[model samples]
Target: MPKLRKAQVMILDGILSILMAMTISYVLFAAWPQHRETTGQLALERAGYDIVNAFYEDKEIYQTIRKGFEAKGYLSASEVEYLRTRLYNYGRMLGVSRIDVDIEGSEQFSVEVTHSTPARREQFTLIMPLRGGADDRIIRVSLWE
Candidate 1:
Protein backbone atom coordinates (compact mmCIF):
# COMPACT_ATOMS: atom_id res chain seq x y z
CA MET A 1 0.00 0.00 0.00
CA PRO A 2 1.07 3.56 -0.65
CA LYS A 3 1.99 5.72 2.38
CA LEU A 4 -0.98 8.01 3.22
CA ARG A 5 -0.57 11.82 3.37
CA LYS A 6 -0.99 13.49 6.86
CA ALA A 7 -4.28 15.28 5.94
CA GLN A 8 -5.78 12.09 4.46
CA VAL A 9 -4.72 10.07 7.49
CA MET A 10 -6.26 12.62 9.89
CA ILE A 11 -9.56 12.61 7.95
CA LEU A 12 -9.71 8.82 7.99
CA ASP A 13 -8.88 8.77 11.72
CA GLY A 14 -11.67 11.27 12.44
CA ILE A 15 -14.24 9.17 10.59
CA LEU A 16 -13.06 5.99 12.31
CA SER A 17 -13.21 7.62 15.74
CA ILE A 18 -16.75 8.89 15.18
CA LEU A 19 -17.93 5.48 13.99
CA MET A 20 -16.30 3.74 16.95
CA ALA A 21 -17.85 6.16 19.42
CA MET A 22 -21.32 5.71 17.98
CA THR A 23 -21.02 1.92 17.94
CA ILE A 24 -19.78 1.81 21.52
CA SER A 25 -22.59 4.05 22.73
CA TYR A 26 -25.28 2.05 20.99
CA VAL A 27 -23.98 -1.21 22.36
CA LEU A 28 -23.70 0.11 25.91
CA PHE A 29 -27.17 1.67 26.09
CA ALA A 30 -29.07 -0.90 24.05
CA ALA A 31 -28.28 -3.93 26.19
CA TRP A 32 -30.84 -3.18 28.87
CA PRO A 33 -34.58 -2.68 28.34
CA GLN A 34 -36.22 0.70 28.78
CA HIS A 35 -37.51 2.24 32.00
CA ARG A 36 -40.48 4.56 32.24
CA GLU A 37 -39.77 8.25 31.98
CA THR A 38 -41.99 9.52 34.76
CA THR A 39 -41.16 8.20 38.19
CA GLY A 40 -44.74 8.23 39.51
CA GLN A 41 -46.17 6.19 36.67
CA LEU A 42 -43.23 3.85 36.71
CA ALA A 43 -43.54 3.47 40.46
CA LEU A 44 -47.20 2.61 40.12
CA GLU A 45 -46.59 -0.04 37.46
CA ARG A 46 -43.68 -1.57 39.32
CA ALA A 47 -45.54 -1.51 42.58
CA GLY A 48 -48.60 -3.24 41.14
CA TYR A 49 -46.69 -6.03 39.43
CA ASP A 50 -44.25 -6.37 42.28
CA ILE A 51 -47.13 -6.65 44.68
CA VAL A 52 -48.62 -9.55 42.71
CA ASN A 53 -45.37 -11.45 42.16
CA ALA A 54 -44.37 -10.89 45.76
CA PHE A 55 -47.67 -11.73 47.37
CA TYR A 56 -49.88 -14.03 45.34
CA GLU A 57 -47.56 -15.48 42.69
CA ASP A 58 -45.03 -17.01 45.06
CA LYS A 59 -43.98 -20.48 44.10
CA GLU A 60 -41.30 -20.24 46.73
CA ILE A 61 -41.45 -19.00 50.31
CA TYR A 62 -40.05 -15.63 51.33
CA GLN A 63 -40.66 -12.76 53.71
CA THR A 64 -43.73 -10.82 52.70
CA ILE A 65 -43.18 -7.68 50.62
CA ARG A 66 -46.80 -6.50 50.65
CA LYS A 67 -46.55 -3.94 53.42
CA GLY A 68 -43.48 -2.33 51.92
CA PHE A 69 -45.27 -1.51 48.68
CA GLU A 70 -48.40 -0.52 50.58
CA ALA A 71 -46.41 2.00 52.57
CA LYS A 72 -47.08 5.62 51.63
CA GLY A 73 -43.58 6.26 50.38
CA TYR A 74 -43.22 3.48 47.80
CA LEU A 75 -46.63 4.04 46.23
CA SER A 76 -49.35 6.66 46.31
CA ALA A 77 -53.13 6.59 46.10
CA SER A 78 -52.90 7.74 42.51
CA GLU A 79 -50.78 4.76 41.84
CA VAL A 80 -53.33 2.53 43.45
CA GLU A 81 -56.04 4.06 41.34
CA TYR A 82 -53.91 3.62 38.29
CA LEU A 83 -53.50 -0.06 39.01
CA ARG A 84 -57.15 -0.58 39.76
CA THR A 85 -58.11 1.03 36.49
CA ARG A 86 -55.58 -1.01 34.60
CA LEU A 87 -56.73 -4.39 35.87
CA TYR A 88 -59.59 -6.13 34.09
CA ASN A 89 -62.13 -8.80 34.89
CA TYR A 90 -61.82 -12.43 33.82
CA GLY A 91 -62.21 -13.00 30.05
CA ARG A 92 -61.96 -9.34 29.22
CA MET A 93 -59.30 -7.54 27.16
CA LEU A 94 -58.78 -3.86 26.73
CA GLY A 95 -55.90 -1.41 26.35
CA VAL A 96 -57.58 1.66 27.84
CA SER A 97 -55.28 1.70 30.84
CA ARG A 98 -55.96 -1.99 31.21
CA ILE A 99 -54.21 -5.35 30.84
CA ASP A 100 -54.70 -7.55 27.83
CA VAL A 101 -53.35 -10.94 26.86
CA ASP A 102 -51.82 -9.80 23.63
CA ILE A 103 -50.35 -13.20 22.85
CA GLU A 104 -50.82 -16.83 23.76
CA GLY A 105 -48.42 -19.72 24.17
CA SER A 106 -48.36 -23.14 22.66
CA GLU A 107 -50.94 -25.55 24.12
CA GLN A 108 -53.10 -22.48 24.87
CA PHE A 109 -51.09 -21.52 27.98
CA SER A 110 -49.98 -17.93 28.12
CA VAL A 111 -50.10 -14.57 29.91
CA GLU A 112 -51.30 -11.13 28.82
CA VAL A 113 -50.67 -7.57 29.98
CA THR A 114 -51.51 -4.12 28.69
CA HIS A 115 -51.02 -0.46 29.61
CA SER A 116 -53.02 2.23 27.83
CA THR A 117 -51.28 5.55 28.50
CA PRO A 118 -48.65 5.01 25.87
CA ALA A 119 -49.64 1.92 23.85
CA ARG A 120 -49.67 -1.82 24.26
CA ARG A 121 -47.32 -2.76 27.10
CA GLU A 122 -45.96 -6.03 28.37
CA GLN A 123 -43.47 -7.57 30.80
CA PHE A 124 -41.34 -10.67 31.00
CA THR A 125 -42.88 -12.67 33.80
CA LEU A 126 -43.03 -16.12 35.33
CA ILE A 127 -46.44 -17.30 36.42
CA MET A 128 -47.07 -20.07 38.95
CA PRO A 129 -50.62 -21.27 39.36
CA LEU A 130 -52.03 -21.14 42.86
CA ARG A 131 -52.65 -24.87 42.79
CA GLY A 132 -49.43 -26.22 41.21
CA GLY A 133 -47.06 -26.14 38.29
CA ALA A 134 -45.58 -23.01 36.64
CA ASP A 135 -46.06 -21.11 33.43
CA ASP A 136 -43.99 -18.53 31.57
CA ARG A 137 -45.24 -15.39 29.94
CA ILE A 138 -44.89 -15.76 26.19
CA ILE A 139 -46.13 -12.58 24.53
CA ARG A 140 -45.54 -9.18 26.14
CA VAL A 141 -46.78 -5.83 24.87
CA SER A 142 -44.98 -2.47 24.77
CA LEU A 143 -46.09 1.14 25.02
CA TRP A 144 -45.95 3.00 21.75
CA GLU A 145 -45.63 6.54 23.00
Candidate 2:
Protein backbone atom coordinates (compact mmCIF):
# COMPACT_ATOMS: atom_id res chain seq x y z
CA MET A 1 0.00 0.00 0.00
CA PRO A 2 2.54 2.53 -1.15
CA LYS A 3 0.84 4.81 -3.65
CA LEU A 4 1.27 8.23 -2.03
CA ARG A 5 2.84 11.01 -4.05
CA LYS A 6 0.80 14.24 -4.05
CA ALA A 7 3.94 16.11 -3.16
CA GLN A 8 4.36 13.54 -0.43
CA VAL A 9 0.88 14.29 0.90
CA MET A 10 1.44 18.03 1.03
CA ILE A 11 4.68 17.78 2.86
CA LEU A 12 3.27 15.38 5.38
CA ASP A 13 0.31 17.62 6.13
CA GLY A 14 2.52 20.58 6.82
CA ILE A 15 4.69 18.63 9.16
CA LEU A 16 1.67 17.41 11.05
CA SER A 17 0.38 20.90 11.58
CA ILE A 18 3.60 22.15 13.03
CA LEU A 19 4.20 19.25 15.32
CA MET A 20 0.64 19.57 16.61
CA ALA A 21 1.10 23.18 17.48
CA MET A 22 4.26 22.57 19.37
CA THR A 23 2.75 19.82 21.40
CA ILE A 24 -0.26 21.85 22.42
CA SER A 25 1.75 24.86 23.35
CA TYR A 26 3.93 22.88 25.66
CA VAL A 27 1.01 21.35 27.48
CA LEU A 28 -0.92 24.57 27.87
CA PHE A 29 1.80 26.86 29.14
CA ALA A 30 3.90 24.22 30.77
CA ALA A 31 2.05 21.39 32.49
CA TRP A 32 -1.71 21.61 33.10
CA PRO A 33 -4.01 22.89 35.90
CA GLN A 34 -5.30 25.95 34.04
CA HIS A 35 -2.43 27.99 35.41
CA ARG A 36 -0.49 31.23 35.45
CA GLU A 37 -2.94 33.62 37.11
CA THR A 38 -1.11 36.84 36.35
CA THR A 39 2.01 35.30 37.71
CA GLY A 40 0.09 35.27 40.97
CA GLN A 41 -0.36 38.98 40.86
CA LEU A 42 3.26 39.60 40.14
CA ALA A 43 4.25 37.55 43.12
CA LEU A 44 1.88 39.52 45.29
CA GLU A 45 3.21 42.88 44.35
CA ARG A 46 6.74 41.89 45.02
CA ALA A 47 6.05 40.44 48.43
CA GLY A 48 3.92 43.41 49.27
CA TYR A 49 6.65 45.88 48.58
CA ASP A 50 9.05 43.89 50.65
CA ILE A 51 6.51 43.81 53.42
CA VAL A 52 5.74 47.45 53.30
CA ASN A 53 9.42 48.17 53.21
CA ALA A 54 9.97 45.95 56.18
CA PHE A 55 7.22 47.80 57.94
CA TYR A 56 8.10 51.43 57.47
CA GLU A 57 11.74 50.82 56.91
CA ASP A 58 14.61 50.03 59.30
CA LYS A 59 12.58 48.51 62.15
CA GLU A 60 9.61 48.70 64.46
CA ILE A 61 6.86 46.95 62.55
CA TYR A 62 4.47 46.72 65.47
CA GLN A 63 7.49 46.08 67.60
CA THR A 64 9.13 43.78 65.13
CA ILE A 65 6.08 41.84 64.03
CA ARG A 66 4.93 41.99 67.58
CA LYS A 67 7.88 40.09 68.91
CA GLY A 68 7.53 37.44 66.30
CA PHE A 69 3.81 36.99 66.83
CA GLU A 70 4.15 36.92 70.58
CA ALA A 71 6.86 34.33 70.32
CA LYS A 72 4.73 32.12 68.10
CA GLY A 73 1.44 32.29 69.92
CA TYR A 74 0.08 33.62 66.60
CA LEU A 75 -2.16 36.02 68.38
CA SER A 76 -2.30 38.32 71.44
CA ALA A 77 0.46 40.82 70.95
CA SER A 78 -1.29 43.36 73.22
CA GLU A 79 -3.86 43.73 70.43
CA VAL A 80 -4.57 43.77 66.67
CA GLU A 81 -3.52 40.15 66.64
CA TYR A 82 -0.10 40.60 65.18
CA LEU A 83 -1.34 43.18 62.76
CA ARG A 84 -4.14 41.07 61.42
CA THR A 85 -1.89 38.10 61.21
CA ARG A 86 0.61 40.03 59.20
CA LEU A 87 -2.09 41.08 56.81
CA TYR A 88 -3.37 37.64 56.16
CA ASN A 89 -0.22 35.64 56.37
CA TYR A 90 1.42 37.96 53.93
CA GLY A 91 -1.62 37.21 51.83
CA ARG A 92 -0.99 33.52 51.89
CA MET A 93 2.60 33.59 50.85
CA LEU A 94 1.61 35.66 47.81
CA GLY A 95 -0.51 33.07 45.99
CA VAL A 96 -3.56 34.45 47.75
CA SER A 97 -5.83 31.46 47.35
CA ARG A 98 -8.67 33.79 48.30
CA ILE A 99 -8.97 37.09 50.07
CA ASP A 100 -11.24 40.10 50.58
CA VAL A 101 -9.61 42.92 52.45
CA ASP A 102 -10.23 46.54 53.28
CA ILE A 103 -8.30 48.41 55.91
CA GLU A 104 -10.20 51.66 55.46
CA GLY A 105 -7.10 53.83 55.31
CA SER A 106 -4.82 54.57 58.19
CA GLU A 107 -1.17 55.46 58.44
CA GLN A 108 -1.70 53.43 55.29
CA PHE A 109 -3.86 50.35 55.28
CA SER A 110 -5.58 48.58 52.45
CA VAL A 111 -5.31 45.21 50.81
CA GLU A 112 -7.18 42.87 48.56
CA VAL A 113 -6.24 39.50 47.17
CA THR A 114 -8.53 37.03 45.48
CA HIS A 115 -7.62 34.04 43.38
CA SER A 116 -9.23 30.71 43.48
CA THR A 117 -9.74 29.62 39.92
CA PRO A 118 -9.35 30.46 36.28
CA ALA A 119 -12.15 32.99 36.39
CA ARG A 120 -10.80 36.02 34.59
CA ARG A 121 -12.03 34.73 31.23
CA GLU A 122 -11.42 31.08 31.62
CA GLN A 123 -9.98 28.87 28.89
CA PHE A 124 -9.12 25.26 29.38
CA THR A 125 -8.82 21.87 27.73
CA LEU A 126 -5.95 19.61 28.37
CA ILE A 127 -4.41 16.18 28.81
CA MET A 128 -3.79 14.06 25.69
CA PRO A 129 -5.17 17.10 23.92
CA LEU A 130 -4.91 20.79 23.05
CA ARG A 131 -6.24 23.96 24.59
CA GLY A 132 -6.18 25.99 27.78
CA GLY A 133 -5.90 29.60 28.74
CA ALA A 134 -6.72 31.21 32.03
CA ASP A 135 -6.58 34.30 34.16
CA ASP A 136 -7.62 35.32 37.70
CA ARG A 137 -5.13 36.97 39.98
CA ILE A 138 -5.72 40.00 42.05
CA ILE A 139 -3.26 41.38 44.59
CA ARG A 140 -3.26 44.70 46.31
CA VAL A 141 -1.49 45.72 49.49
CA SER A 142 -0.62 48.79 51.45
CA LEU A 143 0.43 48.46 55.03
CA TRP A 144 1.88 50.95 57.42
CA GLU A 145 1.73 52.23 60.97
Candidate 3:
Protein backbone atom coordinates (compact mmCIF):
# COMPACT_ATOMS: atom_id res chain seq x y z
CA MET A 1 0.00 0.00 0.00
CA PRO A 2 1.20 3.52 -0.80
CA LYS A 3 1.35 6.06 2.06
CA LEU A 4 -1.02 9.03 1.48
CA ARG A 5 0.24 12.65 1.63
CA LYS A 6 -0.57 14.70 4.79
CA ALA A 7 -2.95 16.98 2.83
CA GLN A 8 -4.92 13.99 1.45
CA VAL A 9 -5.30 12.48 4.96
CA MET A 10 -6.57 15.81 6.31
CA ILE A 11 -9.04 16.12 3.44
CA LEU A 12 -10.38 12.59 4.10
CA ASP A 13 -10.85 13.42 7.82
CA GLY A 14 -12.64 16.66 6.95
CA ILE A 15 -14.96 14.87 4.56
CA LEU A 16 -15.78 12.20 7.15
CA SER A 17 -16.51 14.86 9.78
CA ILE A 18 -18.81 16.74 7.40
CA LEU A 19 -20.70 13.55 6.54
CA MET A 20 -21.14 12.71 10.24
CA ALA A 21 -22.47 16.20 10.99
CA MET A 22 -24.89 16.01 8.08
CA THR A 23 -26.19 12.62 9.23
CA ILE A 24 -26.75 13.95 12.72
CA SER A 25 -28.50 17.03 11.41
CA TYR A 26 -30.77 14.90 9.23
CA VAL A 27 -31.66 12.65 12.16
CA LEU A 28 -32.54 15.62 14.32
CA PHE A 29 -34.63 17.23 11.59
CA ALA A 30 -36.46 13.96 10.92
CA ALA A 31 -37.28 13.66 14.62
CA TRP A 32 -38.50 17.26 14.86
CA PRO A 33 -42.18 16.47 14.26
CA GLN A 34 -42.24 13.81 16.92
CA HIS A 35 -40.73 16.21 19.39
CA ARG A 36 -43.24 18.89 18.42
CA GLU A 37 -46.12 16.43 18.80
CA THR A 38 -44.94 15.48 22.27
CA THR A 39 -44.68 19.14 23.22
CA GLY A 40 -48.16 19.81 21.87
CA GLN A 41 -49.58 16.90 23.82
CA LEU A 42 -47.95 18.20 26.98
CA ALA A 43 -49.36 21.66 26.41
CA LEU A 44 -52.82 20.21 25.86
CA GLU A 45 -52.51 18.17 29.04
CA ARG A 46 -51.44 21.27 30.94
CA ALA A 47 -54.35 23.23 29.53
CA GLY A 48 -56.78 20.50 30.60
CA TYR A 49 -55.32 20.51 34.08
CA ASP A 50 -55.51 24.30 34.25
CA ILE A 51 -59.17 24.30 33.21
CA VAL A 52 -60.08 21.77 35.90
CA ASN A 53 -58.04 23.68 38.42
CA ALA A 54 -59.80 26.87 37.49
CA PHE A 55 -63.14 25.27 38.28
CA TYR A 56 -61.84 24.07 41.61
CA GLU A 57 -60.17 27.33 42.52
CA ASP A 58 -63.03 29.65 41.73
CA LYS A 59 -65.14 30.08 44.87
CA GLU A 60 -68.37 30.81 43.03
CA ILE A 61 -68.08 27.89 40.67
CA TYR A 62 -67.01 25.57 43.46
CA GLN A 63 -69.88 26.65 45.66
CA THR A 64 -72.38 26.25 42.85
CA ILE A 65 -71.35 22.66 42.19
CA ARG A 66 -71.24 21.86 45.88
CA LYS A 67 -74.66 23.39 46.30
CA GLY A 68 -75.98 21.25 43.50
CA PHE A 69 -74.58 18.16 45.15
CA GLU A 70 -76.18 19.16 48.41
CA ALA A 71 -79.55 19.96 46.88
CA LYS A 72 -79.51 16.99 44.56
CA GLY A 73 -77.21 14.03 44.48
CA TYR A 74 -76.17 15.13 40.99
CA LEU A 75 -75.97 18.38 39.06
CA SER A 76 -79.20 19.99 37.95
CA ALA A 77 -80.03 21.07 34.40
CA SER A 78 -79.44 24.74 35.19
CA GLU A 79 -76.11 24.04 36.81
CA VAL A 80 -75.02 21.96 33.84
CA GLU A 81 -76.03 24.76 31.55
CA TYR A 82 -74.00 27.23 33.56
CA LEU A 83 -70.99 24.93 33.35
CA ARG A 84 -71.41 24.58 29.62
CA THR A 85 -71.41 28.32 29.15
CA ARG A 86 -68.44 28.88 31.42
CA LEU A 87 -66.44 26.10 29.79
CA TYR A 88 -67.21 27.40 26.35
CA ASN A 89 -65.95 30.84 27.30
CA TYR A 90 -62.86 29.45 28.88
CA GLY A 91 -62.17 27.24 25.87
CA ARG A 92 -62.34 30.27 23.66
CA MET A 93 -59.84 32.08 25.83
CA LEU A 94 -57.53 29.11 25.67
CA GLY A 95 -57.83 28.95 21.88
CA VAL A 96 -59.28 25.47 22.13
CA SER A 97 -62.55 25.11 20.26
CA ARG A 98 -63.44 21.59 21.39
CA ILE A 99 -64.02 20.63 24.97
CA ASP A 100 -65.94 17.80 26.63
CA VAL A 101 -66.79 17.60 30.30
CA ASP A 102 -68.11 14.51 32.08
CA ILE A 103 -69.31 14.58 35.64
CA GLU A 104 -69.65 11.13 37.21
CA GLY A 105 -71.47 10.75 40.47
CA SER A 106 -74.77 9.07 41.12
CA GLU A 107 -75.35 9.56 37.39
CA GLN A 108 -72.97 10.01 34.47
CA PHE A 109 -73.43 13.38 32.79
CA SER A 110 -71.51 14.38 29.70
CA VAL A 111 -71.53 17.76 27.99
CA GLU A 112 -69.78 19.14 24.98
CA VAL A 113 -69.07 22.80 25.54
CA THR A 114 -67.57 23.85 22.22
CA HIS A 115 -67.80 21.83 19.04
CA SER A 116 -65.00 21.82 16.47
CA THR A 117 -66.09 21.99 12.83
CA PRO A 118 -63.43 19.44 11.96
CA ALA A 119 -62.79 17.14 14.90
CA ARG A 120 -59.38 17.42 16.46
CA ARG A 121 -57.01 14.46 16.46
CA GLU A 122 -55.12 15.38 19.64
CA GLN A 123 -56.81 15.25 23.03
CA PHE A 124 -55.92 15.36 26.72
CA THR A 125 -57.95 14.41 29.78
CA LEU A 126 -57.92 15.61 33.36
CA ILE A 127 -59.70 13.86 36.21
CA MET A 128 -60.36 15.85 39.36
CA PRO A 129 -62.21 15.21 42.58
CA LEU A 130 -65.48 17.04 43.22
CA ARG A 131 -64.79 18.82 46.47
CA GLY A 132 -67.21 19.03 49.42
CA GLY A 133 -68.96 15.88 48.35
CA ALA A 134 -69.54 12.93 50.65
CA ASP A 135 -69.29 10.37 47.90
CA ASP A 136 -66.39 9.97 45.50
CA ARG A 137 -67.43 12.17 42.64
CA ILE A 138 -65.03 12.95 39.82
CA ILE A 139 -65.08 15.46 36.99
CA ARG A 140 -63.33 14.49 33.79
CA VAL A 141 -62.33 17.32 31.49
CA SER A 142 -61.18 16.50 27.98
CA LEU A 143 -59.67 19.16 25.74
CA TRP A 144 -58.76 19.22 22.07
CA GLU A 145 -57.58 21.85 19.67
Candidate 4:
Protein backbone atom coordinates (compact mmCIF):
# COMPACT_ATOMS: atom_id res chain seq x y z
CA MET A 1 0.00 0.00 0.00
CA PRO A 2 2.88 2.41 0.72
CA LYS A 3 4.49 1.67 -2.66
CA LEU A 4 1.18 2.25 -4.41
CA ARG A 5 0.83 5.64 -2.70
CA LYS A 6 4.38 6.61 -3.73
CA ALA A 7 3.65 5.84 -7.40
CA GLN A 8 0.51 7.99 -7.29
CA VAL A 9 2.48 10.90 -5.72
CA MET A 10 5.19 10.71 -8.42
CA ILE A 11 2.60 10.76 -11.21
CA LEU A 12 0.94 13.80 -9.68
CA ASP A 13 4.31 15.64 -9.55
CA GLY A 14 4.99 14.84 -13.20
CA ILE A 15 1.57 16.15 -14.22
CA LEU A 16 2.06 19.37 -12.30
CA SER A 17 5.47 19.93 -13.88
CA ILE A 18 4.03 19.49 -17.37
CA LEU A 19 1.24 21.94 -16.61
CA MET A 20 3.74 24.56 -15.43
CA ALA A 21 5.86 24.13 -18.56
CA MET A 22 2.82 24.57 -20.79
CA THR A 23 1.77 27.71 -18.96
CA ILE A 24 5.19 29.28 -19.33
CA SER A 25 5.29 28.48 -23.02
CA TYR A 26 1.87 30.00 -23.60
CA VAL A 27 2.77 33.22 -21.79
CA LEU A 28 6.00 33.76 -23.67
CA PHE A 29 4.45 33.10 -27.06
CA ALA A 30 1.39 35.22 -26.37
CA ALA A 31 3.41 38.28 -25.35
CA TRP A 32 6.14 38.05 -27.96
CA PRO A 33 4.28 39.92 -30.74
CA GLN A 34 3.09 42.69 -28.44
CA HIS A 35 6.62 43.22 -27.17
CA ARG A 36 7.96 43.41 -30.70
CA GLU A 37 5.30 45.94 -31.77
CA THR A 38 5.99 48.14 -28.74
CA THR A 39 9.69 48.22 -29.53
CA GLY A 40 9.01 49.16 -33.15
CA GLN A 41 6.76 52.02 -32.12
CA LEU A 42 9.43 53.31 -29.76
CA ALA A 43 11.98 53.32 -32.54
CA LEU A 44 9.61 55.22 -34.85
CA GLU A 45 8.93 57.77 -32.14
CA ARG A 46 12.63 58.35 -31.67
CA ALA A 47 13.09 58.79 -35.38
CA GLY A 48 10.30 61.35 -35.55
CA TYR A 49 11.88 63.39 -32.79
CA ASP A 50 15.23 63.24 -34.51
CA ILE A 51 13.73 64.68 -37.69
CA VAL A 52 12.08 67.55 -35.80
CA ASN A 53 15.27 68.27 -33.87
CA ALA A 54 17.32 68.37 -37.03
CA PHE A 55 15.19 71.18 -38.35
CA TYR A 56 15.38 73.00 -35.02
CA GLU A 57 19.17 72.83 -34.78
CA ASP A 58 19.99 73.55 -38.40
CA LYS A 59 21.45 77.00 -38.99
CA GLU A 60 20.14 77.08 -42.54
CA ILE A 61 16.65 76.33 -41.33
CA TYR A 62 16.88 79.11 -38.78
CA GLN A 63 18.17 81.47 -41.43
CA THR A 64 15.35 80.62 -43.80
CA ILE A 65 12.76 81.05 -41.09
CA ARG A 66 14.24 84.34 -40.08
CA LYS A 67 14.12 85.45 -43.66
CA GLY A 68 10.44 84.57 -43.81
CA PHE A 69 9.69 86.41 -40.61
CA GLU A 70 11.52 89.44 -41.88
CA ALA A 71 9.64 89.34 -45.16
CA LYS A 72 6.27 90.27 -43.67
CA GLY A 73 5.08 86.90 -42.38
CA TYR A 74 5.52 84.81 -45.51
CA LEU A 75 8.14 82.54 -47.01
CA SER A 76 9.20 82.74 -50.64
CA ALA A 77 8.57 79.96 -53.11
CA SER A 78 12.25 79.13 -53.25
CA GLU A 79 12.60 78.94 -49.50
CA VAL A 80 9.64 76.59 -49.34
CA GLU A 81 11.14 74.44 -52.04
CA TYR A 82 14.44 74.27 -50.24
CA LEU A 83 12.75 73.11 -47.07
CA ARG A 84 10.68 70.54 -48.93
CA THR A 85 13.75 69.10 -50.62
CA ARG A 86 15.66 68.88 -47.38
CA LEU A 87 12.79 67.07 -45.67
CA TYR A 88 12.47 64.65 -48.55
CA ASN A 89 16.14 63.83 -48.31
CA TYR A 90 15.90 63.24 -44.62
CA GLY A 91 12.97 60.92 -45.10
CA ARG A 92 14.88 58.96 -47.69
CA MET A 93 17.88 58.57 -45.43
CA LEU A 94 15.69 57.36 -42.61
CA GLY A 95 13.99 54.71 -44.81
CA VAL A 96 10.64 56.40 -44.42
CA SER A 97 7.93 56.15 -47.03
CA ARG A 98 6.40 59.56 -46.39
CA ILE A 99 7.17 62.78 -44.57
CA ASP A 100 4.97 65.71 -43.69
CA VAL A 101 6.21 68.96 -42.20
CA ASP A 102 4.10 71.78 -40.85
CA ILE A 103 5.70 75.06 -39.90
CA GLU A 104 3.76 77.69 -38.02
CA GLY A 105 5.47 81.02 -37.70
CA SER A 106 4.47 84.43 -38.89
CA GLU A 107 3.03 82.30 -41.68
CA GLN A 108 2.01 78.67 -42.11
CA PHE A 109 3.88 76.27 -44.36
CA SER A 110 3.11 72.66 -45.11
CA VAL A 111 5.01 70.10 -47.17
CA GLU A 112 4.50 66.44 -47.81
CA VAL A 113 6.17 63.75 -49.87
CA THR A 114 5.00 60.18 -50.39
CA HIS A 115 7.29 57.60 -51.92
CA SER A 116 5.86 54.22 -50.95
CA THR A 117 3.46 52.26 -48.83
CA PRO A 118 3.35 52.91 -45.11
CA ALA A 119 3.32 50.33 -42.35
CA ARG A 120 3.78 52.60 -39.36
CA ARG A 121 3.77 56.30 -38.61
CA GLU A 122 4.89 58.69 -35.87
CA GLN A 123 4.73 62.46 -35.33
CA PHE A 124 6.67 64.96 -33.25
CA THR A 125 6.22 68.66 -32.63
CA LEU A 126 8.67 71.26 -31.38
CA ILE A 127 8.34 74.89 -30.43
CA MET A 128 11.28 77.23 -30.68
CA PRO A 129 11.75 80.96 -30.57
CA LEU A 130 12.96 82.73 -33.65
CA ARG A 131 15.06 85.91 -33.82
CA GLY A 132 16.24 86.23 -30.24
CA GLY A 133 13.09 84.74 -28.64
CA ALA A 134 10.95 87.63 -29.70
CA ASP A 135 8.61 85.26 -31.57
CA ASP A 136 7.80 81.58 -31.23
CA ARG A 137 7.38 79.04 -33.98
CA ILE A 138 5.99 75.52 -34.13
CA ILE A 139 7.38 72.76 -36.30
CA ARG A 140 5.73 69.40 -36.64
CA VAL A 141 7.19 66.41 -38.45
CA SER A 142 5.37 63.19 -39.28
CA LEU A 143 7.20 60.14 -40.56
CA TRP A 144 5.53 57.17 -42.20
CA GLU A 145 7.14 53.81 -42.63
State the lDDT of candidate 1 residue by residue for 21-73, as single tens digits.
Answer: 87888798764446857555564455445434432444221111122232321
Task: Give the winner by TM-score: 1 or 2.
Answer: 1
Per residue, candidate 3 scores C-alpha lDDT tens digits across 1-145 of 2456777888999999998887898787853334333466566666776787777786666766777877776778888777767777777777675776666663444445456463453434434444533455566666776
In candidate 2, what are the lDDT values of residues 28-116, reduced to their tens digit? 87744465555644555565565555444534444543343345533233434445556566555644443332221122233344434
Q: Candidate 1, residue 8: CA error in Å?
A: 50
Report the CA-based lDDT of candidate 1 relative to the real structure.
0.38
lDDT of 3 at 16: 97
After superposition, candidate 2 runs with Cα above 4 Å error? 1-45, 56-60, 64-82, 85-95, 98-145
- In model 1, what are the clashing residue pairs, if there are any? 101-112, 120-142, 121-141, 122-141
TM-score of 3: 0.59
Candidate lDDT (C-alpha), each: 0.38, 0.43, 0.65, 0.73
The model with the greatest TM-score is 4
Candidate 4: segments with Cα more than 4 A from true spot: 1-38, 105-114
Q: Order the candidate numbers by lDDT, best to worst.
A: 4, 3, 2, 1
Predictions: Cα RMSD each: 14.9, 17.7, 7.6, 6.9
The ten-residue window of minimal lDDT in model 2 covers 122-131
